[model samples]
Target: MSDHERKQLEDFLAAIEPNIAGYNYSTFSYLAQKKGNVFELAQGRLVLQGVPATSESKHFESPNLKVGFLHLHELKTSVKQFIESLLTGKLLTPHGELRFAPEKDRSHSIYFNPFHAEGVPFQNRQAFQYRQMQLHIRGDRRERLDSLSLDWELKAGPIPFEGVQELCAEFGVGQIDGDSSTVEIVAFSVAAIGGESSVTGTKAKLVINLVDGLEREKASIGYRLIERNAVVKRGILSGDALTWENATNFQRGVAELEVTGGAVLHCVASHGGRAQHHYWVADPATAQNPFRAIHQAFDKNLDVLQELVTKAQTKGANARDLEIAVAWLLWMLGFSTTHIGGTPKTSDAPDLIAATPFGHLVVVECTTGILKEDSKLSHLFQRAEKIRQTLISCGNQHLRVLPVIVTTKTRDEVKSELDQAHKNGALVATIEDFPQLINRTLLVPNAERLYTEAEENLKRLQNPSPFDVSGTKTNLLQ
Candidate 1:
């Protein structure tokens, strides 16, 4: 960083030190590994290497490919199987090494249904040329944030092109067509998405890695961190609801930390007001409750939002500028993970979930335009109350669902609505007063200020320089 950049960062840190401390935090990103290799945890130690493909798939790479990933829908499907196994008193694997994909050779990118007996590795380039399905993941999403490109093919017989189509659609790819080469074919269309779950106590990330036609390797890394426990990562949601399975807990935590590191690089972080004094980042041992990290981050967003509203030199801004500036704090809270609870029909989706350590859910929302002291702020309370009631009527009200009414107005005015709501029984919180979050104490220096000032400067930067007749000219948009 240049002197100017360094100075700016220092200024940012100095500005938002207060709000972070209350959130009670200590820790930073904690993930590591290499690409094109396989990783599994046996005893708190990471097993990283290339998973050899089945003999039939080995020639091209591996005959069969197995990738251990987290999928909410898939989990639901496995829920019944899990219950059946338990009831039958089936022998349980001593080590909770859950297999998510087909067992295949390391090089084989193609994935087949694991329901049937396994096959042998490939012996010819034909498999490489004819693809069955190529899995493009947020590159090493568990440990590395960078997205990657991987392809798998079928050579033993005519490719099941339809199954390939089905898989392609899942990644937003249109279809495939055989090229001049007999074995090689190409698919069209692809996209990706990513975020972090600060609310889901499980904190398992969702990796969506496709966008438009171009694919950015580490597409989207997301997790739901909604737990209140000594070791936040240890309370992950797996095996069953209301319970956490010690399923490669250590390895999974490491991968999640790795993925978060990669994803946060694309975002930013910061806090302010009485909350920074106790924030921890260097040594995690002295950190606050890890489970509730995301919730506290969400609360701190109000502080950042207040700062942004105050920093606004002008009374008005471009619509996009206003939206981007206010939303900055919400996203910074690391609300990347998408939470799934309701069935396919009649279920509502919360903008955020404040979860308990044992998979309990809390709903929170942040809305713009609630100027401090504005009478409309009262309406926010009504909205929150209604949301709470809706959840209650659905029988989920038994859980502590804290709905918040967030705005970017100054504290003097916001405090009124907050006070009124507090008196009326709303779980009111400000982004400025959230507790320290262990997972994001030092997410990025001066993140709140950096993101705020960056957006402001970015807006003004649109003013173009004079046509450069004598100096180097550049077009950065492309």
Candidate 2:
């Protein structure tokens, strides 16, 4: 949680991502702290914690980034138990000094709370702190938490370094200068807030914390349980509700859960801009597989345009030069070069990345082919571009911002803009050109990856079975 960043902090995030998946902030809160430092966190408001639907409000891939407040009281005791086992090797309860653990389904981000509060198992130590936020989630274990990863966040507070040795040693956190005014602790957290819920009988558990701004006061938020149904309506299966009209194999049950328990988390922080894409896995077995035969006349078939950009536009551009710059650019996007375009295309991005002999990094974007309408990443383009710019300040940032790749309808749109930024010395590509089956270099969606992210998006939405994602929110619960 931060606004203006320092060179060190910026550089740190540039190289070491703190699990910034495809999420946007919907809330921000700062607890009053007298002597401790306060770090701001703008995490995902909507979490992918349920089995996804093959279709959403319109389709079945991505829904709008959702938001909901979380509170310690709302989350049942054993909610984050699976997560605690992964980290502190304990269980979640209403007693203890303080502990941090991961949600079972989601491991990328961890939960923070007082091991146990003051007077009782759940008493407020600080009486002054009073800022809070509210969040709502459709209660479902299968509808909760997915994936797992580890990263860092900035936190400034007086270290209760006496008895927290177990926590610090486990996470490899070292004690730094004790200056409360200006010291950044490499706080540890885990999570991979992605799609496709496999948890069938789960509920969200809230975490209670006593540090950070809690030194003087308490910051609290309420967790709301909303009844969200993971279903698809038969009407959506018909061609009338889809943006991609050609999808004929369209069926409510086609979409299967790919990645389950993507480790979704929520925080009271308002944030803006595009972050990164977590290679969050969905249990394909359980996820809703949404890809079907649809009549999408809009598919632009940007393959030809992508070929022109990489083969023709990069006439004098060194493959190494492009890889270094673009890798660094996309790294800020929270994804390695594993998932590039939505699906497979020509001019494979993985090959391009492999050819780059530079010790540059690999950046990947996981835009699905079924989402784009005008070929562009659509609404998410600006955030991706912003992330590209944010990471450029890093010394050895190697970045690549691939284009959006969803369906055939988006082909023409991508074909023309394949090299929009190439003229300005930026490396860009569309899904039509990336091939990365054998190598882990490019994050291009295959039949499996495509189904996973899409299925998760569909399940996380509040819909009925056989429902269609027509005119629905496209943001995934990042």
* Highest lDDT model number: 1
lDDT of 2 by residue, 1-478 (tens): 1232233334433422222231111111111111122111112122211112232121000011111232223234222232233234222322211122223453222222211111111011111112221121111112111111111111112222122222232222222112121111221211212122222333322222222211111122121121211212111111121122112221111112211232222211111211111121222223221110010112122223233224322324333332332333233222334333323572333322211223333223223232333333433455455546765876434644332322221233344543333332222333222221101111221323332343344343334245553313222111
Instruction: List residue ranges in candidate 1 displaced over 4 A.
Output: 1-314, 317-376, 434-478
lDDT of each: 0.27, 0.24
For candidate 1, the per-residue lDDT at 407 reads 42
lDDT digits (tens) for residues 307-419 of candidate 1: 44343323452222323333443344333223221234423443344343333333444343443333434544555566667768888766443344444332333533444
lDDT of 2 at 158: 29
RMSD of each: 24.9, 23.3
Off by over 4 Å in 2: 1-202, 212-217, 221-478
